[model samples]
Target: MPRKLKVFRTAAGFYDAYVAAPSRKAALAAWGAERDLFARGAAEEVTDPALMEEPLAQPGTVIKRSRGSAAEQFAALPADRPKPKRVAKARTAKVEPAPPPEPAPKPSRDALDAAQDAIDVAERDWRKEQRELAARQAALDRERRDATERHEQALADLDRARRRAQEDYDAGLAA
Candidate 1:
């Protein structure tokens, strides 16, 4: 008959892997190789024939009611002390009235033209940088592909050399 085993974790942060085998030595050996046991904490064997006769309880569905005392003692705790209040200060200096705001000067035609030219130059530079980046990426990809092809070719050449050497050695043995 197959044995039932349970693995559990201990309070010491170490896993206690349990496995039921024919012998204690066999159980230890099986436990060492059990990946789940090493990852978990502890285990117990619940293979009693009498326990198996009882029906299994449905998980999360069954609610067991607990007994409570008829007379319960109640106590009110003291509240924390309130913070001290701050004193208000009297103002002595007289406040001055604020002056009216001045209107902003409008931009000149030359300034507007210069601003548009600067924006155009910035966009042109950005496009140029994007193109340069694309070119660099393409070059890097090409180099990587070339290197991989070269490596594969070298491996094929080495295999051919080995086969030739083996053939020559067999021919010499025959002679």
Candidate 2:
């Protein structure tokens, strides 16, 4: 007979695990050794089989029935009756005249010059901002490096002081 185990974990709530082993000790040993089974949870044997069985349907759950399956429901359809013959009618198509092409407006010389000046100014400003940003980033990076070095130096000094104190105490105790 298969043994059922209830495993619980922080992440995964609770689950039923089936073990093929005969004894609980054997099952625990086998499961504990196998990393794949209950990888994250704590496991214990469960006596009730109802914990493992899942309900076929829950309350308020809708089961969809296909209309095609009920052939008798559509047996009385009007498809058995012959459809009325459609009468053919003549349709007249009207011809439409093509619209005149619109003329394209020419740009003024001053407008063109102004647009070019705006683009040049924007480009210059972008480059200047980029250079300033790079300088600031470099300065920040230098400061961070200096701070890290100072921290390490302080740690080394503390270690040296501790060692000196320990050595002095040891020498006094030996005397």
Candidate 3:
């Protein structure tokens, strides 16, 4: 099995890595090597340094060799077992048609009517709920629009007031 090293960067300045070694020691070694490579400015691939810690290195997160090309590693990885062959059903002459599925028992007329009534009631309630939701959404939209318009009007009023005050000041100075 070809070994794979997955590497990415974190937002911080430190180099974070996950190395899926053949053993835990190998993984630790890989991480140390990556840290050294980063310190020496020899590593090209780096993810956020924040990824180096617990959650990133925990169970499922992938952190391996951040310095090498992931594509090259993926290409280099060996293929597993070959896919199983599909057996053709038509080639087997002993095939017989499957038995038809048994029909479900039908309910009595009164039971069917009651079920239909229940369905109709449920449908009506669903439609009512949909209409209520639509109305609520529309109301919320209207409220938001009104709030925006009010904010704009208030800003305009403030600007006008400031301009008037400035003009009054100028007139007083002139006088």
Number of the top TM-score candidate: 2
Judging by lDDT against the true structure, name the best candidate: 3
| Tens digits of lDDT, candidate 2, 1-175 | 5344332211122223344344444555544545433343454443545532321122112122333434654673657767899976546755568887878887679988999999999999999999999999999999999999999999999999999999999999999
Ten-residue region with minimum lDDT total, candidate 2? 55-64
Worst 10 residues of 3 by lDDT: 6-15
lDDT of each: 0.54, 0.56, 0.62
Kindly report which residue pairs in candidate 3 clash with one another: 6-64, 8-47, 9-47, 9-48, 10-47, 10-48, 11-48, 18-63, 18-64
Q: How does model 2 fare in lDDT?
A: 0.56
lDDT of 3 by residue, 1-175 (tens): 7554434332222323453334444443544444545445544343446543543455334454343467865776788889999976776578679999999988669988999999999999999999999999999999999999999999999999999999999999999
What residue runs in model 1 are displaced by over 4 Å at the alpha carbon?
A: 1-107, 170-175
Per-prediction CA RMSD (Å):
31.4, 31.3, 33.0
Q: Best to worst by lDDT, what's the order?
A: 3, 2, 1
What are the clash counts of all predictions, listed in order? 9, 0, 9
Q: Lowest summed-lDDT stretch of 10 residues in model 1?
A: 58-67
Would you give me the overall lDDT of model 1?
0.54
> What local lDDT does model 2 show for residue 147?
100
CA error at residue 153 for candidate 1, angstroms: 1.2
TM-score of each: 0.34, 0.37, 0.33
